[model samples]
Target: MKFPQYFSLLIVSSLLFACSNESDSDTEKSGIPAVITPVPLDTYFPPITRTDEWETVSIETLGWNENQVDNLYTYLEDNDTDAFIILKDGRIVIEKYFGDFTKDDNHAWNSAGKNLTSMLTGIAQQEEFLSITDATSQYLGEGWSSLTIDQELSITIKNQLTMTTGLDYNVEDAFCTDPECLIYLNDIGTTWYYHNAPYTLLDDVIANATNTDFNSYFSEKIKEPIGMQGLFIKVGYNNVFFSTARSMARFGLLNLNQGTWDDTPILLDTAYFNSMTNSSQDLNLSYGYLYWLNGKSSYRVPGSEVEFTGSLIPNAPADLYAGLGKNDQKLYMVPSLDLVIVRMGSASSEIQLGPSGFDNELWGLINEIIQ
Candidate 1:
């Protein structure tokens, strides 16, 4: 299916004109043009407080078209979105609670919670708790999978993070964490498949490596320091997290700063952070270590073998990346724009997993408003 191209021409024109018309004075004052000067990162590090409120940026100050912004919210509400928020320079630029949802309503992160697990796993490695290079069986024990000891040993922690574990997704219960459900499909790193069983197993890896409960480890290491409130509750075989929309935004802001919360370094392993947000393997350029990356030449979605051409979300900025969840729960970060966005609620459509057509449509609306 092709994405809508209604705003394609206008978007291209706006970007090109902005790039080609930098004045000499602008260049002299700063190496970059004034219009494109990055918002200082230090200016908006949210105070690490236990309160439910966050600082916000006025829409007028953002110079956003008010009519378009209203229309954006209307469109979101029409599509079953329970909550939507847009953050500019770490301040809430647009915050809306739809239906019966309020700012304090807790919502499930679904698969988007994987992004948090990925970050915490990096911290675990940094603290000498575990190593990505280590085999998955090393921590989970040798019989965690149905594969032979040798075949399972070949699957490393890195494979799990990159979705290159070569685990079979054709089983009766793909989400099942039982050893019998984790059948080997190919040699490690030979293919990339968005299998949930392997990804969910990362929790066990972290738990075993750190000798602490997953949620407690997360609280002490990440949530407490950043003033984020949430818990990874077990749902069947999956450990999904639930939090308020603002807490989701906080995590996005943390990622926007590359794992740092304000001046404090929540994840001091810079190398892991870089690898975690970029393409993690040669198989899928659009996938990092559990996060979804945009601006890649091609991408592969869950349950599909066909490769789609172009960036994952064409209407979003080229530098955009996201932690997308089932039912359209989204946490997007655009470093170039100094922006972070969150959306939570029921499924916008029948699509499951990450990078759905609704993403393109929603971003198209966002482009109309922000431009």
Candidate 2:
């Protein structure tokens, strides 16, 4: 779900028009054009609700006094961190960025948007939009429904959420297209591949079930309630959304609070929180329902051996969950630390969505100060 750096501006322009035909005139009625205003890097720190909650600690306090966070800033500046913010104990702890990124700049969350969509699924199911147990074909109509007679019969919403749909991730046309496009590579529940097309179709499932567009539904149910002025961008996919790094942090903090937003039960199905944070697929123990898990020590790499290492913190509480995107756009929530750390920027690495060793390294550094 991560867009290339070249598309950042393109996405912003599209964001303004995302709801143009989608029945979201209220956004314009409120006088907020979908237009994105660029913000300077240094001024991107969002106003904290309560600054006293932030306990600033040096890298040394986190066991890396010699490891300057300023060095990290220098690296980000040389690279591209449009916007980044970190929260510890519900307060801003570290906020920094580079280039034109700012507090108000609405950067694309890419696949990280999937994590939000996954939560929306829980909400939809809670509202009885459709049960997770329903077969994918149930909502997808004839084209996708035909798969039942064939090998695709096993596919289900659960499989889609867990990414165990068993469809070949290699097919370009089918990979991106719906129903007619996807051919079962293996059987359902057999493989783990980052298949985008099937995941995108889940948007339609959600949309059809509720008789609403994904973006509007999400805003009314999740974003608006949490006070996050988020705009879900409609890219080539069916249900992609865009939000400021601050808005993204708001969602992560909601998860950090286990589905409660300011004492309100925005997500009625709070039981799904733990399941969303834990691995749902047997193939990749590090991934959950669109969210990445930090509790695992091994990662499967394509064309390479499985890499193994300890997690960020020894005996770290297993409740830490995250939404990760390309170029290192991250929303990390750790219930144990009562912390939500957000980093949005173009890192030096081109493939930012893989098993980013950076997560462990950065968390290790942050934990030094937390403990």
Clashes of each: 0, 13
lDDT of each: 0.88, 0.68
Cα distance off (Å), candidate 2, residue 210: 0.7
lDDT of 1 by residue, 133-172 (tens): 9999999997998999899889999999999988889999
Best by lDDT: 1
Give the alpha carbon lDDT tens digit for every residue of 1-371 in model 2: 98898799888778767867455667657777765433212211223341222234433333334445666566556556677676654555567766766777777787678888899999898888888778887787656733546555567888888877877766665336655567757778877777777888888889899999878898788877766776776666444567777778778878876787756786777667678778776677777888777667654532233444655334335667777766667787877766677777665465655446566556655554455
User: TM-scores, in order shown?
Assistant: 0.88, 0.76
Candidate 1 has its poorest 10 consecutive residues by lDDT at: 33-42
lDDT of 2 at 245: 74
